[model samples]
Target chain A: MVEAFAVASGKGGTGKTTSTLALGMALAEEYDVTVVDADTGMANLLFHAGLADVETTLHDVLVEGGAPVEAATYERFGMRVVPCGTSLAAFEAAEPERLRAVVADLAADADVLLLDSPATLGSKSAILPIVLADRVVIVLQATIPAVSDGLKVQEYALSYGTDVAGTIFNRVRGDVESAAEKADRYFEGPLLATVPESEAAQQARAAGRPLLAHAPDSEAATAYRAAAARLDPRDGDSGDVADRFRSAVVPDPP
Target chain B: MIPEGELLRSRVVTDLATALEDVLDRHLDGYAVLAPRETLLGAADGRGVLTFEDGVPACAYHVETDRGGPAALGDVGAGPYRFELYALEAAALEIAHDADELRVPPGMPAERLAGDPALATRTRRRAGVDADRPDDGGALEAFLEDEATVERIRESARREARRRAEEWGLGDALADRPDG
Candidate 1:
């Protein structure tokens, strides 16, 4: 039973790409995971995957419709990354519905797919994954504006009918939980999980490596791993939070 | 009581905006911190937006290297800022990887939420299409609706926050606190 999760942000820089690879990696540990760079406008998940020879890409499926999902897939780091080829123009020009059809074909190749998207639903075609994704995981910042944008995106997705699995509080620090809470309240689902703010992610993005792989033991890395646990297909306790915190996340899967 | 993790994170963002505001006050009349509709429009407004998902605070330089040529999103300035904000997209990856403990505050009012049953049904239908033949057009229409809603709600949120602060004293004591 494969599941498709669309990783879209109301804005960029919400740790969408990094989370995609990390989650895919974590899931790959148990399930066959595939990460697709839906950011055809700026397809860079390959950079996050730390793979340079992304000779084959998502464009083949969208434009040429040449390869089946497996052909467009790149198995790396023990996972498959369906890179958004280097052609932004092609992706932008491709029809939104056609792209969705292509991705659907592509999703068939993997048990779990992470569709990485760009910020803003600017291009109607660009957002195919948001509403179509089996689980829409909205990424949020801890700021009033960031939270607001996230809430709006989630609300909109829900309104238009997207299964907003939950909110991902990224780049959070000492006080973001409240901001995230406000967002969770208005959003149609739970604020499910959060990622502690860390410099490690910046370092990883620059170095082109997953934080877990590069700084495996860093607090940020551990936090990333914990976040992955919450997204797991399995339902149970991760035992990483305060007892009260544990109960807060487990019972509510919005 | 501050929920330092959440409050501090929000404070830092406000702090960043204030810092930007100072720059704007001293340099420009009104500068917008262009971000996706998903970005907190509560900050200064800007038509040109950048991805700021990281929670750590750092000043990025607007390094204009090329026009219609290759340009990299560059950070040119460095300062002793208090905190940082992670790019939300990247955070999603970390969460998926089970890297960090993406904890929602124990204080979030989850009980107050109202799930949009439509979302689940739509997702189910898409899931069916996803498994076989996903209608890309349908997805696109849906995505547009979501995106449009994101921008609209962001606007509503900005107004709401302002209302709360002005009428409800949300930022009453914090006004005296060293926000930036």
Candidate 2:
């Protein structure tokens, strides 16, 4: 079965896109992965993935009635990508509701699909990726505001009947144990991985490459691999955490 | 909401095509009517022949009746329709028409046009158009079609884009900043 994970965050600057790309690269080691830039309004994943100049994008599929397969341009590094256009015209013209169909079409070919969603939870377009996904993996920093915002995203995903796969604590710094304990307590699901702040991640972003490709030996890349391992839907352990959390919160009396 | 450039382009193209059709209806005997495919949504069918110019749907035509002509001519279905082609912008406008409602006038500002309660509710019910305030024509078209309107729309789109970009931290990501 194809498993689609929408990488989302309540607020911006949470390394959501980076985590999506990094985890995608790691998952590609064993599965056919496709990372989609579902953030139609402010698309930057193409640039991050060094595919900024691609002519065909998700905009064409959603707006111009083009085939979804035509939008998959970058097919290398054991993965593919459906990039979104940066122009305001493309964003305005796109039919956000069509994403459900697009996702369905893509599921035929990909084993793992990672959608990098927009930061905002307000826009109908922003919620589309999560609504269509089988699971949602939130990326967030370890802080009160970030945790609260991540919880909002979690609740939003749950409202749509999508499973919260887990949360990845990105850019962990200073104290690892304390951050992990705090995140475990606040977050509803499992803490997938704690990626430490590293210069290699920044360098990979600058080089427009995934950390797995740019710095394979880096700590950030290792954390991403660990996270991807946990996210593997084929693994029997990778069940819906939201269901478990729900049962725990309101357990049925025996 | 429709982009100003796209709204303007669609209006110009549809107006020119509609004017041509009106003239053809008045004069020519059994002549084919050519129009922008998008504007002629109510009329276009499987039999209509769509032609592309510069990678855009320039015009679409359907023969009223097939008058036996030269074999080569029949292949292209070209006839004495006196076709007048006008090149406008490439973008196509999505015009929503409910058989029960009055057709939105071409070139009418989107905000003013959507202000009609019936049309507003109808457009909102449609999937692709804006749900709250469907601006099919555009918001800034009330001003003179000069640099002011252009600048205003440009500024508005820029601000909107910037706000979205900031919300996603796209600027910092594009600049390769660690702060993102």
Candidate 3:
């Protein structure tokens, strides 16, 4: 069985890449998780996953007549990671439509697919992960603009018929219980977990490792594990998921 | 209601912390009006009034929502705002400051409105606050309570999504595509 999730936040500075890797690591304990850096334009999952020095990435697989998807895939931190190159030239050369095929290929081999999506909904390419995913897990910071942006992304995902898996309130300080409780009312899913602001999370990024690997004892890591527990990836026929991805209509480049 | 004060400085500022810091540095006794030219939430007419005691925020109010204190801070949207700082006498602000409903924690404005935690800590220190008072999230709670604003955001996003779907050739995937 396989389920694809687009881990998205409408705007940046919400620790989305970190959350993606953290969730992937936590979920990998019980399932075969394939994490893809679907944010081709601003990919940082490589840095967070310690795959920054990999020779091939999603970008290499996305170019016309490019490398096979398997060539870009790596086994890292107990999961399969498809990192994206941080080169402007690679991003410019890569065709966004090829992502559907790549995700379809990965879906066949994994129990769960987590797309580390772009932080914006401005471009078709950026919104593609949300469009293709079975559900979206919105990452949020407890601030006005962050929540507002999260709400907007949720609407876009719902409009395209993607389910709201849940929301993770990241980098939280002080009491956000009341706010998160109230905000949960507007969301279709529960408040999965509130990840506290942690120096370890920042240090993990600097060390080029997932937070679970770098500091499993940290509160943030504990919260991530709880989030993964709450996710409860639904049973989906891998063949059906793969076929859906393969059959998905590719949008025109913006 | 706050008594009118002498105009000290007025300018459009994108960052709210800078204006707050200026007031703190000058140790000004007065109030400031923050009127966003356009809010991120699409509410342009809403404005926040923050009164300062020795440059530390003492009370707050939002003109459009008729909300005061922490809730008013929630009403203050992300800025590129017309910030009008005025100088007022301490005694003149005494009545408004004494209104419990309008009083805000000294650092609440910095933390909630500016999204700057460090600035909040500093402001708390400057105001002689104990620093352990947990933020009740009154501002965000208030923001969530504003159903009209939230609905506007959702409605706008829905329209944008539909329009973008057509533009990007993803109209077939929309939940309610007419042709489908």
Candidate 4:
């Protein structure tokens, strides 16, 4: 069985990359998880996943007649990670639609696939992960823009026939229980976890490691683990998922 | 009600923090009027009125909702909002600022509206030294509880999603596409 989740937020600086890898690491203990940095335009997962030194990446797999998907896949922190390169020329040279086939190929072997999605819903490439995912995990901060943009993301996912797995309130400060309760009313899924802002998360990023791997005992890591537990991964035939991705109708490049 | 001052800035800002941070950094003795850019209630539905003293938030009021203080902050939900900042003499706002019922803590706007904790902390520190106003929380909860505004946000997003789906040629993927 395979379930793909797009860990997404509409706005930036919401610790999306951190939350994605943390969730990926926590879920890895229970399932064979594969994480893909689908945010090709502004790919930073390579830095976070410690794959910054990798010679090949999703960029290589995306360009025509480039590397196979397996070449870019790296086993790190007990999960399969496919990080995107940061080179502007590479990003420009890569084809966005190639992500569909790559995700499909990765979907065939993993029990869970987590797509670290782009922060904006601005372009086809940005929204494609959400459109293709079986479900989305909305990451939010208890502020107007974050929540507002989060609502926009949720609506976009629902409109595209994607289910909302749940919401993770990241970088929370003080008590947000009341706000979380109020927010849960608007979202399709439950409030999975509220991760407090932590210096450990920032330090982990600087150390080029996921929070869970760097500071497993930190409050943020614990919250991410709790979030993973609450995320009830559903059963979907990997063959069907792969075929759907391979056949998913994406618009022609401009 | 407070009297107006000279207009300093007026434009549509996607993030309220830009306006708030500007007000804070400039130490401007002024006020700002924030109105939702897209709303069935129009810009007049409820224009949020926030006053600042030395770039620290002093008081808040929602014109249409007839609510004051932190609740007014809630009335001013997500942006991009039409933000207009007006410069005022400290003497001009002195009396109006005394209305404790209409007062908001220094960091509430940054915290609740901007969702910027760093700005909130800075504002709080500035408030601690510049102004000693009592603090309160729950604007996010208040915004969420305003079912009408929340529904409006969701409704507008849904509309935008479907409209953009067509533009991006992903209309067929829409769950409620006419032909689907």
- Candidate 4 residues lying further than 4 Å off, grouped into runs, are A251-254, B39-44, B129-137, B177-180
Ranking of predictions according to DockQ: 4, 3, 1, 2
Residues A13-129, candidate 4: write the lDDT tens digits: 999999999999999999999999989989989999898899999999999999999999999999999999999999888988888999999999999999999999988878988
Candidate 2 chain B has its poorest 10 consecutive residues by lDDT at B70-79
TM-score of chain A of each: 0.81, 0.87, 0.98, 0.98
The true-versus-predicted C-alpha distance at residue B79 of model 3, in Å, is 5.9
Error of 2 at B30 (Å): 85
Alpha carbon lDDT at B16, candidate 4: 80
TM-score of chain B of each: 0.20, 0.20, 0.80, 0.89
Greater-TM-score candidate between 3 and 4: 4
For all predicted structures, in order, the TM-scores are 0.55, 0.53, 0.88, 0.96
Per-residue lDDT tens digits for candidate 1, residues B5-45, read 21213122322334332322232211123233233334322
Looking at model 4 chain B, report the run of 10 residues with the lowest lDDT sum: B129-138
Query: Which candidate achieves the best TM-score against the true structure?
Result: 4
iRMSD of prediction 2: 25.8
- Local error of candidate 1 at residue B3 (angstroms): 38
Query: Candidates ranked by lDDT, best first?
Result: 4, 3, 2, 1
lDDT of 1 by residue, A123-142 (tens): 44454465456567788655
Chain B alone, candidate 1, TM-score of 0.20
Q: Could you say which candidate leads in lDDT?
A: 4
| B13 Cα displacement, candidate 4 (Å) | 0.8
Q: Give the TM-score of candidate 3.
A: 0.88
